[model samples]
Target: MLDFTNDSSGGEPSSQAVKQDAISDQALLDAYSNAVIDVTERVGPAVVRVETGSKTPGARERGGLGSGIVISPDGLVLTNNHVVGSSRQIRLRDNEGIVTEARVLGVDPDTDLALLRADGARELRYASLGNSKSLRRGQLVVAIGNPLGFESTVTAGVVSALGRSIRSVSGRTIEDVIQTDAALNPGNSGGALVSSAAEVIGINTAIISGAQGICFAVASNTAQFVLSEIIRHGYVRRAYIGVSGQTAPIPRRHAVAAGVDNKMGALLAQIEPDGPAARAGLLPGDVAIRLDGVDIHGVDDLIRALDRDRIDRTLEMEVLRMGRLRTIDIHPIERKPSARQGSAP
Candidate 1:
């Protein structure tokens, strides 16, 4: 009789090892599937379906569908502005399968985030916010949303990269974006990109065309900052000191005081005429020591601080000019509203 479980050597040991390997492989696959499924079920209730429309002159109302995420128990939801683009009518669908009307509370087309509030909807399921700064590459993440009108859809993948910049369909550059391989469709905008702990790290906003598994999300840090500003004021109040700068190695003189040679910081490229920096007597070649009492180590740091604050707010700046240190207070003006919002669609 031929031995079915053994090789030609007829040993019991070889067959046992092969069987164990197969079992282990199967177990790993099962675990992965279960994990994806489990996460989806837990978070899907907070994802919502949104319908947007607008009434144009001499035309019937135009509208579309997208996804949204509840960020507050009192009915605040975050979604894409384009999804709610020019829409006078906004409808929100709750987890209990009820559809109700909503209104836009605030919107920032630069980041493509819009805040919505439901009338009289006090009871809502909100997602927990996570710190996107702590996320590492290859960490597991899941996206929950409505795709192609398919409500409550979930997809999973690992974080492909961070700090990616993507231009929207309308041609605006989105900064500090999160990239992932998770499947996201049109309706996925404003959905949540959550960590294993179920904390919302990002909001699904855009995807590259004809690309498989390439999706972009707005970082939660940016989202939270924008959301808080919107909730506080009707619009984003960003401070803008009218100065464009570049990073340059610190000169020997300033390096000594900074305690580092070969250090990098803003190299004043241009100070707009009559602008805050110019009006405050900041000339070209002046090394900025600090802004608003916070150290300005580089141009990026300065930009980050200004990105979320209100325009026309006064900031104290310390600078080194002609081997002399001076302090000045300057206020930033708002960027013109005519600036293109999003990438050109």
Candidate 2:
């Protein structure tokens, strides 16, 4: 007679082992749920609904609506510049249903970030910005925002990519952007993209329309820089060497001849007449390899090197022109607000 009894040592997992595996799986699921719950409980209160409008007689009653996060106990709120636009009046409503008037402290349209101060608000709940540089792909993140007029909605996702570049409404490229799979909608802009530790790692900014699971946020490091500059000055002071450029591959022969280790460079496609580059003898075809001893492998690299401190300062720019290395002394000037025509180096 064939053996009717079930064998415990068979290839299939035993009942006891299966029970233990189920328990482990449940534990992991519980941990993930608990983390989301904890972050929501801690950081959700700081997320506020931002409403902007113009008080003009003929202007629209409600101009724009989005989300913001209070980053200081004294109610310093951070949001997206696009959300506020050119509105003259801004109102904020916290999670507790307390409404307050806010005024724009400053705005950096290049980074798509804005800072606001709640009028006469004191001792308000706030969230802390975390180090976004430490974030890795696949790390869990939570997004808290007001989507489609809904207040304090939370969604969880993972960091899909890093070091992304996105274009701001002002037609500037925002570098080091964080890409995530978090579900974001029309009203989610200017909200908080939080890490599992309940720290604001990024500011939820843009969502690609017609694309699923593709969203972006301004990294907290970039936001922090914008915040400090706006607090100290009314606007971000960027150094400009007037030129329009694109990243181009350095020819192997040219790289070897010029003794440059860079595989790519910012090819100066156009130079403004009488601008810094033109005055410094930098031609349109010059490929910049270094700026003041710093590598300029691409346009973004060159842009970052020309910060506020570099304004009015003469810097040595290393370029490869006609397969020969040349050093040009260029003086960077303060970028004018009206000169937003092309990419400012």
**Cα lDDT computed for each candidate against the true fold:** 0.79, 0.91
| Residue pairs with clashing backbones, model 2 | none
Tens digits of lDDT, candidate 2, 100-146: 99999888888888999999735679999999999999999999999
Residue 212 in model 2: lDDT? 98
TM-scores for every candidate against the unseen true structure? 0.71, 0.86
Candidate 1 residues 1-345, lDDT tens each?
Answer: 865665657556675798999999999899878877777776778889998875689997568989999888888889887788777689998667888789998888868888999777468778878899999999889999989988888889989999998755443456889999989998899898988778889999988889998999999998898889888877766666777776666777866764543366666778888877788888888777677767777666566566545467777877766656677887867754433253111
Candidate 2 backbone overlaps, count: 0
In order of listing, the candidates' clash counts read 9, 0
